[model samples]
Target chain A: MIQIKEVVKTYPARDGGSVVTALDGVTLTINRGDIFGIVGYSGAGKSTLLRLINGLEMPTKGEVIVDGKEISRLKERELRQARQKIGMIFQHFHLLWSRTVRENVAFPLEVAGLPKEQIRKRVDQLLERVGLAERADAYPSQLSGGQKQRVGIARALANEPDILLCDEATSALDPETTASILQLLKEIHREMGITLVLITHEMSVVRQICNKMAVMENGRVVETGMVSSIFSQPQQALTKQFVKELQPSTQGDDTSGEVVELPLGDADKLVALAKEHGIRFSVVSGAIAGEQDDCLRVRVDGTEAQMQAVRQVLCGGERAC
Target chain B: MLTGIDWNQVSVALGETLYMVSISTLFTALLGIPLGVMLTVSDRGYFWENMWVQRTLGTIVNIFRAVPFIVLVLFLFPVAEFLVGTTLGPTAATVPLIAGAAPFYARMVETALREIDRGVIEAAQAMGASRLNIIWKVLLPEAMPAIVSGLTVTCVSLISFSAMAGIVGGGGLGDAAFRYGFQSFNDGMLYICGLLLVVMVQLIQMVGDWLVRRLDKR
Candidate 1:
């Protein structure tokens, strides 16, 4: 479990006359055994937040409490000890190219001062878990991108960390490779019950694996909630844009009607209400005739007054509509 | 031409050259590597980031590196005399040789260490490796191939420095050439010493290249 409390991180600008705030009063709590995904555009402070969790970068202000220890205030020696329980993977895999796969996996174990024989056994088991046992003798350069990530995963797990922070672990891979890597991460989480904190720019990555999600913009968490609820009912403008991008569009060129999305069970009630109000409505996509879908998207043809009325009812006085 | 050359003296000079180069190179590697690692780690944003240490070491290495080997040897005559009790043989010449070549090799080692990916070092840090462990296990191992290549270049330069050492009565092939060849006008001794120096350089380069090839995985 990790709790980031009102953290603010700032770096002195290159000019040395001013500062750039990377994270502005951001607060987040990631529960144990969670696949928590932080999504943002570049420079949105997601990576900064991830680094804070492991004490890799200390906060300019506020506390980072991981497993009940205040990481930001710890000494370097104590921080190193704390870091052994928190493993991280990077976008580039960050593998030691000079070392063989087996040796690379043995690195953390060696750092932890495990015996040579025990390290060998642990590395063997980890390689087997990641399915990279056959390529143990190869250097990082000899492996493909996906295989390199598998090695990264095995190395991260070598210390048996309770929390695994993935900083765009799949961003460098092809889509198929990304899928396989995500699947691998999912399996690792299930088997180990380790807490996973993943920061990525790819919304689909969060959707595929994360149970909880946070949307960040300009060093602030604009939205954070369960993934399912956020997808169904996005609160902020940025969250709405992210969700809209994932929707399957049906009215491609026809910009003539007002499109509204609601739960599938409410579609009939909305249709009867539209008939009572003498408004014409048609199901544009999602859930066509006896097939159940999570969301029911409908296009309504009406005047400005009718459209406003329909929006008022659907939004239930919320500003998102 | 071959009959005019003193084969016994030429063999002795070759042995002296080998002794000077081998001894100076050993000391150079031992001193230069730690100096180079210090220069790298004490740099800005590195694990041991200390501005004072980095700048002080940088200035020292630069001062030693900027001086020509011949001038450095002459300047260090007292030091060689004090350290070796004489400034007249292959053994005494190593004082100036290491002083000149160690800084030169340290700079090269710094460059080799810099060529490594910073992310790899950061990855080691994230794994909770101690700073000493990171230096020995990660930085040194990762930069080894380039370091070995740099040492090879340093060794070749040390060979030439030892020849300069010979010019000042530090007995080696250069002394033989100057005494028996140039002064006596034998010409055969001069040609033979030149050929031996060339052969030594070639052998060093071949071994260096082979080691680099064997070590580099990237």
Candidate 2:
């Protein structure tokens, strides 16, 4: 549904008279109905990329094709028209605070010049969908962070947009709220088949809903592919680092005796080895260095004989085991 | 028994002061609002985003703002004479009052517009709202409370300016106070006019605060 071709975005430093390349000749494609995630830290240009897709910002170079239209080349009128099919939510849940939730949701429809009755009906339905029906009369200030985000979601989906762009939609939310919001997003995707493009520094967000994902670093898409493949076997070093960050760790514990690095395929053998030696071992963390194979960093605790047995099984006779 | 006090003259002066302030305020709102909107939209990264246009318009507003209101009233005498055919009464007083106050109000409008979160504007743009629609629907409504409060401040300034308008042959309470009270050495007249001005300012502030609170759901 979206094709970003060699897009580059540069912003001039507001004070220093220097140019900052926000997106440096990056390219990626997002299929329709796919929940695609662009993961990056601050200043990685993921948000900039999202803006380009919706024509909020034109690319300094190359084209952003959304639903077969080159958004970068579109005139203001055409771009605005194109944008009606592309809805967006923000980290801050940028609802017009002066407006009630229902009115805020109705804004896009109003902009579309939908009839008043129709606008009201549609807003009511959207509020129902986002579970904010009772808060229709409440202004944004009265809503909690999650509720505000729900209103943001309702407003974005008001025009029945084909694409929903979430710019850190749940970043400001607490963990529990983030999970609920992610679940809501998944439900929306499942029901409507609307393409979702979310960018965040949070890997757990991508892991939760994204089917396809991209890893952005220093304004470049260093890696991109199916989420499962990327999680199981990350090709780039940065991707491996991100994947590693999500793995459960037993670091900083004073109890564990030995830490072992074993291939993912050796998990069974390691268990059997631990059993033979009467050692207790747990998969503490793991990292998939694509070329080096997926490895589990396990913590093992037991007497010296048990440690010796584990070392013998894994390392064979290569060392002191 | 009270001596040389003329209640009719006091009432007339009050009426003229009200006339000058109200009329000038209306024009200032009409003119200053658009100027302020223009300044905001043309700002860098905003909808219009024209550096030259933004800077030129900004400089103009600044120049007008920098000129002291009294000097501006005097400076605008010729234009006032050309527009109203006389630089001597309430009608003439409105010319300098608007000229002096509009730019100041425009700056206030710009400030109010600036206070709106850029993220809100970005969200509007992302929804495919046209520049005009963003201004009319998003910018104006979101900034309404601040704009109303700013307008209140502008009205208070205009009231003060109208008093100065007395110096330019613009007859109002200030004129009556100056002639019958200061020049004629009538302390009572000055005190009454001063009290009325204070009451008027207080009334404007109270009304403005109420309106702002009413408008601000944020």
Candidate 3:
């Protein structure tokens, strides 16, 4: 379980005068056993939020409580002990290239002061769980990117951490590999009942595994809710933009000249125009690039009368119509 | 040409060179590596992130590295004599030799450490590794190959620096060449000393390269 209360993080500019706010007055709570997703574009402070939870970076204001203890207030030694229960994986995999896969996984156990034999057995079990038993002896550089991330996952899980923080864990991975890693994470959460908090820019990632989600923009939480509700009835403009991305493209044409924008709930209007006027129409494009309006482009193929009716509907009896 | 030289004296000179270079290299590695690690970890946005400490140590290393070895030997002569009770011979030369080369090697160590990805250090922290564990287990091992290569360069540099110590009665092949060849006009002795120095540097490079290749699994 984790609770963040009005947390703020700021960094002094390298030029030595101004301060840049990385996260501003953000408050959120994650329940135990919940796989929560924090979705944001780059520089939205999602990664910074993850670090606060792990006690790697302290917040400039407010508190980050994990497992009912304030992590920000903990001293270095105590914070390290607390971090033993909070594991993390990274976008870059971060495997020690000089170390073999097994050694990489075993490193935490060794650091925890486990017996050598116990560490070996646990490492073997972890390697087996991640399906890296065969590659245990191989160095990280010899493995593919996906395999490297798998090693990261195994290494993070070695200590049986109560919470797993994934900072863009799947962003560097291909779609298929992302799916498998997501599935593996889901399975781990289910079996171990560990809390999973993943920060990502990928909408599909949260849709695939996260039940609860927070949408962040400009270092603030724009919206937060169940993934299904957010996908269906997104409230904020930024939230709607994210939801729009998940919509499958309705465009069915090989060639098109122009595109028109549509707000949500306009598919019926296009369908009616086509049915009443006997016009052949298809939704061409889903959303345009860097535009506020979430739109759908439609291609019309019809007679002059039908075209005129469609134009009237589109223009709403305005000057163009 | 061979008959003009004393074989015993030539061997002694080679031995003295080896003794000075090897001993100074050991001291340099012992002192330089920790200083370098400190410099890297204390840098801004690094693990320690102490601006004043990083700047101070960096400035000190730069000051030492900028000084020429010949001048450094003379400049440190009083301190070397005070520490070792004499400013002459190979033993006394190691004092300035280490003082001169340690900062240079520390800079190399800093560069080697800088080559490591910061993400790896963060990952180690996230895994509950203490700062000591991260430094020892993660940073050092990850940068081992680069550090090894850097040490090779440092050792070869030390060989040349040790020869410079000969200007102040620091006995080595340089002193032998200065006394026997350059001073006495025995060009053969000078050539032999140059050949031996070159061979010493070559041996250091070969071993260093082999060690680096062995450690670099990536």
Tens digits of per-residue lDDT for model 2, A218-305 = 9999999767557755789999889889976725552357666666787898878766767777665554523333657666778887
Sorted by lDDT (best first), the order is 1, 2, 3
Off by over 4 Å in 1: A248-321
Per-residue CA lDDT of candidate 1, range A1-321, in tens? 899999999998885677899999999999888889999889999999999988878999999999999997889889998898899999999999899999999999999999999999999999999999999999999999999999999999888899999999999999999999999999999899999999998889988988788999999999997675576557899988887777657255434576677767677767776977788886654532222225566677788888877876675432221
Candidate 2 Cα outliers beyond 4 Å, as residue runs: A13-17, A250-321, B1-3
Per-residue error at A239 for model 2, in Å? 1.5
Evaluated on CA atoms against the true complex, candidate 1 attains a DockQ of: 0.68
TM-scores for chain B, listed for all candidates: 0.98, 0.96, 0.97
Better of 1 and 2 by DockQ: 1
Alpha-carbon lDDT, every model: 0.89, 0.87, 0.85
Candidate no. 1 TM-score? 0.88
**In model 1 chain A, which range of ten residues has the least summed lDDT?**
A284-293
The numbered model that scores best in TM-score is: 1
| Candidate 3 ranges beyond 4 A from true positions | A250-321, B1-3
lDDT value, residue A149 of candidate 3: 89
